[model samples]
Target chain A: MSAIERQFYHFAFDPASRVVRMALGEKKLDVTEIAVKYWAPTDELLKLNPSGLLPVLVENYEDGQTVVVCENRAILEHLEELPLSPRLWPVPMQERAEARRLVGWFERKFDYEVNALLLYEKMEKRLMGHGAPDINNLRAGRESLRDHLSYFESLLETRNWLAGRSMSYADFVCAAHLSVIDYFDEMNWQKYPHLKTWYMVIKSRPCFRPLLNDILPGVTAAAHYKELDF
Target chain B: MSAIERQFYHFAFDPASRVVRMALGEKKLDVTEIAVKYWAPTDELLKLNPSGLLPVLVENYEDGQTVVVCENRAILEHLEELPLSPRLWPVPMQERAEARRLVGWFERKFDYEVNALLLYEKMEKRLMGHGAPDINNLRAGRESLRDHLSYFESLLETRNWLAGRSMSYADFVCAAHLSVIDYFDEMNWQKYPHLKTWYMVIKSRPCFRPLLNDILPGVTAAAHYKELDF
Candidate 1:
């Protein structure tokens, strides 16, 4: 098999992109990272993806030929299909569907309630000259987090992993988003012991080492960000 | 093989559920329908699905055997795995990924903007006990729809189907969401000729026939809701 050249375009602060980056690292795929600032949308990136979203992968770029893949979940699935990469999805149809479902659950439901609120209310303002934070929305987001966390706790009580018995893309997709929330000192680890334990296991993995060091402008991770047993 | 008993709980107001219903019809699956009003948020249904969402398919009733599938995209994928159902996903890995991505795009991006605005603002007030419409959000959604429509137009211009040359789950997923918005007369068909033409063809299919006759409480579809040439 020939070596594949890949380029990943992502924003520094975006969690979805971060998840894709972590997956790439896990797969040991060499990729060039192009930074994108969401506040200032560029025409070139817009041409590549009209959705105006981050974490797009361009594969086997050779002057005129390139295949653009958008959506972080799709990118992860694409990488898993490659023979060189470590298997990130379970083999059984039931297990694979469950993993994919959890990925979607985090990306859609958790991201909307937690990541979007935190980014727009807390982070985006610092970067984009937006006005004061919407306290009501943020408060509601925080309140909603408790329920979601409890769900995670119950999920963790049954299995060592998020999706199933095996480690899969679902774990990365979730940890990627949660790490962003953790950076803001927003997650209440005490309330979710099982989740905390699961997170620590993920944090210790070599694949997640680089993620702990990611520094965003005007935003600092929690003091225990790098601590595996926080 | 013993006959598999399936029960589908859905609401007329839900476009996602409608897609599942259409797929069931096409596959000729013998399933019983239990109408559910999404706004009520019943504890019974909530027990079945912690998400409290509609379109939950319960398969194999004897001995309490059941599989609860949420997220319309995931549910459709699960249905494809059933023994007697017609396959909606492509055989090739790349093509399947493309189809799934389009399904996600329609469900998350397009539905979030278009259906959320049109249904929640214009229709939900009458069905549920929601407050008056937010005109600003509705207008913003309409403006966003123009951008999404243009993307769909470009997509339809290149391929006979939404995801590729063959009709797949992606087409049903998109058409399902669009049909909901079209019922409210939210889509400006003249602005996107290709998408409009493509929608007309999908709407005329036998599987889509029930959707044309669907009636939401206190809300009537637009005058041209059933018109194939519209």
Candidate 2:
């Protein structure tokens, strides 16, 4: 086998970054993790990812060639192409499409409606030295979260996983965002037992260990953040 | 061959919807276009797409089976799987990743920074009975559009197509947003010659015909919206 080197540029608290990290672990790729200050990115970081986005994966082969993959969606799909054991994507074509759709839902729709509000206000703004989070924004995010969590719970009531019968990237994407929300003590898990159970299954996986250990200075995680059971 | 029937529920000015339409056309799928009122979706539309988003594609086979695909990213990837004449995705694996990466860049980054601002203010707000557009949002969108257009120009200077040598979904995604911006007479195409040239190439394709013919009520297309040369 050719010598392989991998590195991930990420933010400790960003949901997208967490998703990529979990995907790397699931694929069994030994990668060096580097936290990027997206709000104040360095020149080298910008050169590596022109978009100046979080969760950029860099791979180096023995042939001295390097490839950088940006965007969480791109990174997950790229990882699936590798010869990894226990695939993150389902095998059936229709199931794959459904998984991709749910991934999109969490990445784009849920991110825009929920995470953008919650994270931007609760975490990123403070990190960037902006004023304290706006209460209205947090309220909006919490309202949207209730609806989204209910939707996920409904899906869980029927299927073994978010997409279908197998655990796929869809679960990771949801759990990643949920983890961030849990850090703020925002989720009311009692109302959604099925969704909570689904999350427990994901939390028990080895790939989720690194995410549970992440710590951002000046902001402590919730008491149960690292616990397998609440 | 089994009889195939397809329908697309879309909004006239949504960029994501436009991207799916172009993808379907490129794949030579005969689809009935239904302009959905996303702001005030009917029960039927809501039943078809629980998310109440625009650009939902429904496929019906001759045997009374049906499949509904949501999310433009999922729809584009799904269309690529069909046994169509021209391929929207590239052949090589790495190239395919690059294409998908570029597609992600436009759909998420560009949409958040540019299209969401411009289109929401210029079109959707008014259509939804909101008063006049906000000046600051429009200003922000224009500024971002300049940067995104330059980025596209930079990419075009080196490659024949956005992702690589041959046309792919990346080109269509870009053109989809550009066409919507063009409809509002917001683009300064003369400044970015390379980008303009690239747009012309994509614009001349047969798949772009239906988009050219799309006319939203009370909104007129630019003088060169449908022109082969401008």
Q: In candidate 2, residue A183 scores what lDDT?
A: 86
**lDDT per residue (tens digit) for residues B106-158 in model 1:** 76688787767767788777677778889897888888888888888898898
Query: Per-residue CA lDDT of candidate 2, range B10-109, in tens?
Result: 9877888888888877777788988887789878788876777777888887777677778788788777767776998787555676788888888768
Candidate 2, residues A33-107, lDDT tens digits: the string is: 887888887787888777787788888877776777887887887787677777988876557777888888887
Highest DockQ scorer: 2
Note the Cα lDDT for every prediction shown. Answer: 0.78, 0.85
Model 1 spans > 4 angstroms off: A1-3, A61-65, A84-86, A91-95, A131-138, B1-3, B61-65, B81-86, B91-98, B131-138, B188-191
RMSD vs true structure, all candidates:
3.1, 2.2
Q: Report the poorest 10 consecutive residues by lDDT, candidate 1 chain A.
A: A60-69
